[model samples]
Target: MEATFEAFVRARGPALLRYAHLLCGDAGRAEDLVQDALVKVYRRWGPDIAAPSAYTRRAITNEYLSWRRRLTNREVPTQLPEPATRSHTDAIAERDAVWRVLAGLPRRQRVVIVLRYYEALPDREIADLLGLAEGSVRSLAARAFATLRAHPELRDAASVDRASRAEPSP
Candidate 1:
């Protein structure tokens, strides 16, 4: 059992860390979340479990979703410095802008978006994982999309990008 658990951790640990980072948008917190979930799973590790990867993934998701964890892990953002002027066509800047918007979303909405889009999971599977009804999952996703589409930062960034592309090269 010990060797099996060790092997599983070695194989799946990095993926779990990535998933946790996507779920929470924080690297340190992601590591902590994965570690906590693994500790819980290790206590019950045995040969009878049918799908260790799925089970471990579920555990990590549940840990991220826990309200108690949220209460304890609340982060107060420090004041950010003024943005340096940069070209709108910069891919890294665009990605950073998108990530900032995503990180601002409500926890459940962000989770739904990440699972649905990033993880390429269907709504039904996400609903099951979140212990929410399918309709609720759809609703959450729609709300998240609406928020993303309507976000001022994203709108400004996108408009600038489009305008930059529209201008003919001198």
Candidate 2:
């Protein structure tokens, strides 16, 4: 069955927000991005938009790309204000380190990684949303993974993953 925009948002809004946050690296900007994308999606809503989540995700991605373009054309300072934080646990620190690495990647690579790993979408779906060939999507994912694997923080994660995999389930 098809879903309405409001219902979809209500169900999936947090996931969309997380996607945007990963794309842009700021909570405020992510919220704005999601809002802007939803506005566009709401306008374009029709019977043809059978998959609201896919349509919304494409809109969010396009909005982020457009925002980056505008930011590049401006003379604003590159510095961002530091966010307030409480003492972080090891898990939080690990996630933040991963996010730092993700935020460093080029937009296409970042988006490809996020969609493939975080959203768990197939290559064909990612290609369709990004207007990329399926082979291009696979190559992008491979390159991104290579880049991520080279990071020191992720090296630790790789060791942890291996160790966990070697352990039998309780």
- TM-scores, each model vs. reference: 0.77, 0.77
Give model 2's TM-score versus the native structure: 0.77
For lDDT, the strongest prediction is 2
Cα lDDT over the full model 2: 0.76
- Tell me how many residue pairs clash in candidate 1: 0
Q: What is the C-alpha RMSD of each candidate to the true structure, in Å?
A: 7.6, 5.7
Q: Kindly list the per-residue Cα lDDT of model 2 for residues 1-170, writing each as its tens digit.
A: 22666788899999999989778877788999999999888888888898889999999999988888688543222223344356745555666666777677778988887787667787789999999998998788667666666788674676335422332221
Q: Where does the lowest 10-residue lDDT sum fall in candidate 1?
A: 161-170
Per-candidate total of colliding backbone pairs: 0, 0
Model 1 stretches astray by more than 4 angstroms: 67-69, 76-89, 156-170
